[model samples]
Structure formats: structure tokens, C-alpha cells
Target: MGSPSDPARHLLDLARSRPPTLGDGRLVCIDGPAGSGKTTLAASLAALAGAPVVHMDDLYDGWDGLPRVTDQLDGLLLPLTEGAAGSYRRYDWVLQEYVEAVTVAPAPLLVLEGVGAGSLAHAARCTVLAWVEAPDALRLQRGLTRDGPQVEQHWRRWMRAEAEHFADQRTRDRADVIVDGTAAAPPRSPGRVT
Candidate 1:
């Protein structure tokens, strides 16, 4: 066993050595409030795991529809665990509809990232779950900077929905790791093999 402060290093070691010690395939779920840099962190983690990321925002029908979004998650999760190739359609906000399809190939690790990414409904498939949080004020400012006037209404609605979802889901409580975004670099856990 090892100490509890080097998760990213351990994950990198696992990826470099193709050994069963890493256990079954892994799924890393990165969840956070809007504009918390979830996407940036997810991309870094994917690079570390030598895998690809599946963005949850791409699956939604519109600004609303949590049930349908869950359905989309179900469609992707099974095949990902079974090591089968799968594809999902991405909703295009600009086009006001689902615009195109994206294929996901099974990898040693799969990173699922976005708001609601770490809900308990997904716990079974997730090997490592992380919550990336920032001060609400920081998040709101970032949201405004990113969304612009065109998405102001949509962003507001999404924010309220996220607050409710996080209240019910309590994803932060179940997270294996909690990350605050103010650090120059993300803090890492020393390989705790849950």
C-alpha cells in the first residue's frame, strides 16, 4: 500500500505499465458547478489516463430534460464498461437540435465530465469520482464571460437546474476526491485504490 497523496502519479504509472494490478477498466467522473473548469481538468485527466473524454453537455436535448439526459448516459455507460464501441448524438445549441454523432471507443479509462457527471446513478460504473468546485461568485463570473448575451437566459436556467440537481444528487458527498480551483495546479490524492 502507499500513502494517500499521489493519485495522478499513480494513475500515470498504471497507464504506462499495462498490468492487471490497475484492476478492471476505469471510469473517471469529473463533476462541478458551471464554469468551474471541469472541462479543462477532464482533458488533463484524460491525457494522464491515456483515454478520451465524453462530454455530458453534448447529450442534452436543450436547456432542460434531465430524464432524457440520463437516458443518454445509460446508452453510453453500458458499452463503455463492456468494452464495445459506441456512438451518441450531440445536441447543437446553435442549430437548436441534435447536430452530429460522435463515436467512443473503449479505452483503458473513460473520463465522463460536466455538471451532474458524478451523480449516484453513475456510481456503479465510476472507479474514480472527483468534484471540482469553485466559489459561486467565481463560477458566476466565469459563466458570464463564457456564455455572452446570446446564452444569458439559457445559462440562468441551467444554473438553477444545477443548484437543484446538486442538492438532490449530493455528488460532493460521494466524491473520492475534492478539488478546489484556486490552486495553481490541481491537488492530487496519493493512490488510494478504492
Candidate 2:
């Protein structure tokens, strides 16, 4: 078993090559700020891995739900990690409530993308974790554009929550790979955190 030397083909390839005992033990995490290209990267990896992808946005209770969301995710992923089907209620941003709990079947690889996806507890159970980052200005710009102008105020609140979560969880510090979202093209090489 050798490490993947190329980052061009697919992140899935690199991730699947690493293991933590189980043959199908792989949880690919794409954690980063809003508009940092986590969704795009997760989609690409999912295409290559044929794995199910779940977003943190759907699980968050609200704009300032980062702390709570981590607990929710931890509860959901715990059972799923041990080859058990688990369920979670997706928070409806428009309605501002959890509608129903969606059932998630056990799979070899699950792509979890969004802020706090690769949190300390989650990362400990993951086979490969990727932490994505981009310039603050670019991230804010992308968030404003993607989420619409109405969310500017919410974005500010969310940023504060994100800061607290990251500082405490140390998600980026423990990542197996660091992805630079600012690159015009998908990163050709994994990054190193300063």
C-alpha cells in the first residue's frame, strides 16, 4: 500500500488508498468556509467514489447553529461508522425548523462537506480528511454571491460561530490534506498549513 502521488486524477483515489483497519473504511471530509469550493470538491470526489454526500448546511439548526450541528453530526455519524444505518433531521432554513429525519444507509465511503464536517471527533474516525481554505475577501465575496444579498447579516453571525468552532475543534490542524480553494483550477498538489 503506497500513498497517492498525484492529486490530479481524484481525491477519492488518494483517500481510498489509506485505511484504518476496515477494508471499506473511508470517510472523506471537505471542511472549509462558505464559498470555499467544498461542495464542488465533494461532488467531484463523490463522482469518483460513488459515495453519498451530506452537507452541514442541511443539518445546521440556524445561522448560529455551528456548536449544535457538531453534536448532531457526531450522533448521526457514530452509528453509521459501525456499519449501522442512521438518521438525521435536516433543518429547513426557510421554515426554520427540522422537518423530518432522513435515513442514511451504511456505505463504504461517505463524503461530508461543509464547515465543521471534519471536526475533532469526526476526523479521529476518518480515513482521509481534507481541509479547504481561501482568502477571506474571496470567501466573503463568494458567500454573498451564492447565498444572495439578504444573507449578509447572517454571514457575519455565522463567521463568528465558525471562528469559535474552528478554534476549539482544530479541524484544519488535523487534516490529512489541505486544499487551496483560491486556485483557478483544482489544486494539483495538497497544501501544508502554516
Report the number of the highest-TM-score candidate.
2
lDDT of 2 by residue, 28-133 (tens): 7788777787888788778767889888898989887787876778667877877777677888988999988887777888888899887776656666668778
Which residue pairs collide in model 1, if any?
A: 4-190, 5-189, 5-190, 6-189, 6-190, 7-189
Q: After superposition, how far is residue 13 of candidate 2 from its true place, in Å?
A: 1.9
lDDT of 1: 0.70
lDDT of 1 by residue, 65-167 (tens): 5546777776777676666776788999778798887888777777788887776676677776777788877887788887676777778788889888887
Off by over 4 Å in 1: 1-24, 184-194
Judge candidate 1 at residue 13 and give its lDDT.
46
> Which residue pairs overlap in candidate 2's backbone?
none
Candidate 1 local lDDT, residue 172: 74
